[model samples]
Target: MQFEPGDRRRVLPRHLRPAPAPEVFAYAIRPARPADLPHVREIYNHFVSNSAVTLDERRSTIPSWREKYALLDRLGLPFLVAVSPSGAVLGYAVAQPWAGKNAYRYTVEDSIYLGPGAGGKGLGSALLQALIEACEQRGIREMVAVISDRGAEASIRLHEKLGFVEAGRMGRVGHKFGRDLGTVYLRRALRPSRPRRGALFGRSR
Candidate 1:
């Protein structure tokens, strides 16, 4: 089966949907919508301004993020969000091309972020796991995470717990927050027991 452009169906399979959040934080994880972009941008821009988790020097605007979100939709990639029962966005995760060239079509890069009040509550894990499962369903073979070296042990450990392995580390490759920063690259393989079927990257069979 194939998904058409702009399909609003859930990106993850039923089996991959995360279990209910703890009573203290009831939330649902689902594919992103245009209305969610403002909250998503808020979470991401927080990282952009306060941490090295993302390398963006300038904060992202909603308009730019909208373009990115649409591109991912056209590419059939997953961009998911965790939303509270009250409609607050707790976190988001996305899968993008590892490289722009066609040779890297089978590989993707993942980015995950949570709101300041949402960490250590299992939201990140749940979001990333769903993203992984969605990519697997789409016939992707590998997922890579590029993490900042400073204060990144938690991020590294989170990825490791999810079965990703340290692939490489680029030393002092980025300058941010008035200091040189390094980056850690982690990768996870997603090939399943049965060979994948259907089209990838929006290519028809």
Candidate 2:
């Protein structure tokens, strides 16, 4: 999909065309790379610093982002990003284990964030749909989204539009910015890949 810059909190880099003509640009969604972590952190820290959309109160560091990237790589989970034609990281979507216990292996939690100028253009939905499909391909049975109830109505609606149903809500579970905050949980079941022939049987061939 194509987008024109609007309401950007920052100016576009010199590589991008100026705003008088409203430069039309496109972005590609693909697996994230190690170098993309910095951009990812920048985007995530924006929410952490400015809004109640996320429960986190501290800015994330590059080392932490690298650790997360490495852990997801080792676990065979999906970490995807959207990059503009000029190679700037526009946004990212990732999945992590829903719980540390063995029984929750088939379930994962989704996280998605877009850059300052990269929202409201179907980008979040695109990234989330891609994440869901990636999890399905990995034999995951369920995906969950835990969103803040403070100022995240857009996020809830986005998840709902992509078939996620409200699983439950937990009130006063988190405190950030000197206010009690809650979480709204949404879940979606995926079509996991079928097992290969004789995979469930004892080895007797």
Candidate 3:
């Protein structure tokens, strides 16, 4: 996918556009690079340490995340970051296979995280919207979000704003920070499956 000037605006509909902020216009969304691992790890580790947003119990190391980046590259998946004009990593988003089975090939699970002081400015929405477009371009038929039930209203609202619907909820399936946490599942269909062509007049192509 191409990343051009003001492409973020083009990718997001007007209603979904984050309200203008001091850094909003100064930031651009683009694919993640190797150098971004430190900042990415920082943002992710924040959630791991401070919140149940992610079920990960340990902080992610640079080397470990580097392997993750490599796997995403190997699988041709979308791993994007939102960067400021000064090149600070504001936030990031990624899409991974929802399941490893061949039957789940057309589906993907999305994860998004923003750095401290980056919330409520629409950066999260922008990053997620861009990720959705990238996944759709790659022919992904469905997108899913697995969100923690504890104080994740913003994340849930973001997914709903982007057209995802609540598919299911798992009650107290996760244990984090000495408390049981439930998970909310949201799903959005990217596109309808193409109808398979039947053999014409009993002749296979």
Name the candidate that leads on TM-score: 2
What TM-score quantifies how close candidate 2 is to the native fold? 0.83
Instruction: Please give the range of 10 consecutive residues that has the lowest summed lDDT in model 2.
Output: 196-205
Q: Residue-wise lDDT of candidate 1 within 24-45, one digit each (tens)?
A: 6666778889999999999999
lDDT (CA) per prediction: 0.85, 0.87, 0.85
Q: Tens-digit lDDT track for model 3 on 1-205?
A: 6888876744678989898865224477888899999999999999999998899999999999899899888977789988877899988999998888979988999999999988887777788888877787777889999999997889999999999999999999999999999999999999633333221111011
Candidate 1 vs candidate 2: the TM-score winner is 2
What TM-score would candidate 3 get against the native? 0.81
Off by over 4 Å in 3: 1-25, 192-205
Residue 108's lDDT in candidate 2: 99
Off by over 4 Å in 2: 1-22, 194-205
Q: What does candidate 2's lDDT look like per residue over 1-205, in tens digits?
A: 4456874365568889664765565788888889899999999999999999899898999999999999998998889998887888998999999989989999999999989888878788888988888888789999999999999999999999999999999999999889999999999999988433211101101
lDDT of 1 at 195: 34
* Model 1 CA deviation exceeding 4 Å by range: 1-23, 192-205
